[model samples]
Target: MDAWVSHAGIFSATIKFNEPLQVAWVNTSGDQVTPGSFSLDPLKVKSKRAYINQTVPFTIADEAAFSAFTSAMITQPNFTWHLTSDKLDVRALAFPTAHGLHFKKDVTLNGMNNFGRARLARRLQAARDDPAGGIVFSATTGLDNSSAFNVNLGTGSGANTVIKPGSNAVTLDGRLVPQTGTDALATTFELFTKYLNGEQADVVATGKSSIQADGRAVSWLSAGLTALELHVPFVAPGGAVSPIKAITIGDMSLEFSTHAPWAPVSNSRTVLAAMELPFGFGLEIEEISNRGRCRACQLDG
Candidate 1:
């Protein structure tokens, strides 16, 4: 392999937050999941290229526990996270300008021909006449491929727009990713665990080319029997023959998962032995806090 590679560039990405859910606790002794597991939101975050920046608030049953939990969460190896803002209504740009744009003035402009440029000019004129034309945009951006959504300037699709309330910051990355592998999964999980434990790890962060553990890192991780999911684009074996048929395989998935013991702490804390089961590949530990009670107090009188 050549040690001196040329350079890096920007990439497109897709993100999704599935409906909130909780994993049923399985006693390490049984084959089935325990029904009495605590109810909590196990955040499911999936993104291609990079993970988005989000701020979520952590609530605790007691004020004292809040600090411990927050501290542990910011430092635990078992929990998954991304920071949350106190004001849920605040909007942050999903794509930051300084970090998001990647230029390649030299790479052969693929599908865009002279005719396409002309058509784009006409479309731009039409857009200017539209109500939301003033939003910031780059003339060099690649066209939006998914026609499923009718995006306008303000609607904010491929074009970069100003960060506003409810706006989110997402990281876009471009690199050769493998489909699936055990060694890869193990290594990735180790990094993820370290990240949750407030340790440094290589995570594709949004807006920035790469993000380091800022000592305040918060990103979501998925739980799966075998692997967690990741989003990515694919190029079919044969390139598209027609511009209309430019089959840029976007949003294909990548998955990884883990199994560890969890303490169900509501008004009180309950601990169970670690559940050793088949890799359920989609189990995620969203928030793990450290609450200290006298060990003697936890024992039966």
Candidate 2:
């Protein structure tokens, strides 16, 4: 039972694939950036098994198809990946034949837990029960990404994450991104070279982010919480029951890792910006380089 997941609340689903799949692509090999060796022809894909909500084995019956899929991943310099689009060539996805099942019966979580708390007992029993064919969780989500990165330095210990007292954590977080520089950013392989040579990668984002969002139609939402911040209901008061119709946060990018012994950025004497609201216009105020909001909520007035 293979599963797929994302930054979404956990849920269980049972799906029945009542049809076969079809897919097509163009493949270009060798040193020359020429036409695809494989034509863009839709090929049929047969399901060996379609047991939803379970960890089932799915195989690509066609040998070349399987190889093409596997070769799709050209990983970055480190064990990292950027949620950027310019990465994959859609030309390879010339066309696709989906075995899209009747999505009606699928168990969706929107109506789920709206009442709160999945009983602990049922959760435990679900874990212990047999006939509980393992589960495969996958969801289709339209994605629009600007920039993202995954940096794994091959060092995995609580100590690697330890930010020396008073020292900035971003200076040590085993990763870096350049806001401005002439040198081409290092690749995953090149990043590894730096790690071996004790070189530095710009990891720290120096200033607080600026944002303006229409909560009603926000295209993206990302946030973080350092040791200094906590999860709280952050909403604007539009007259007692304010609907923060929109929101924005420190810049738009979010750092995947936070919480270390870094300096308290909020404590910095440097005043970045100062703005005052004329009383009842509700909103949130935060410090730079520190954890702010991590989750967005849909406020229903």
Best by lDDT: 1
Task: Rate residue 16 of model 2 by lDDT.
Answer: 27
Task: Provide the lDDT at 9 for model 1.
Answer: 23
CA lDDT, every prediction? 0.25, 0.24
- The deviation in Å at residue 103 for candidate 1 is 29
Task: Kindly list the per-residue Cα lDDT of model 2 for residues 155-198, writing each as its tens digit.
Answer: 22222222121211111111222224334533644533443344
RMSD of each: 34.2, 26.9
Model 2 off-target regions past 4 Å?
1-52, 74-198, 201-301
TM-score of each: 0.16, 0.16
lDDT, model 2, position 105? 19
- Tens-place lDDT per residue, model 1, 1-301, is 0011132223342222222222222122323231221112222222212332334432233433233322322222232222211211111246542322221111111110111111111111001221332222112122222111111112223333322222223222223233258888788567435533444433321221111233221222101101211222221112221213222332322222233113222222443334331221234468755443222223244
Clash count in backbone of candidate 1: 40
Q: Name the runs in model 1 displaced over 4 angstroms.
A: 1-180, 204-301
CA lDDT for candidate 1: 0.25
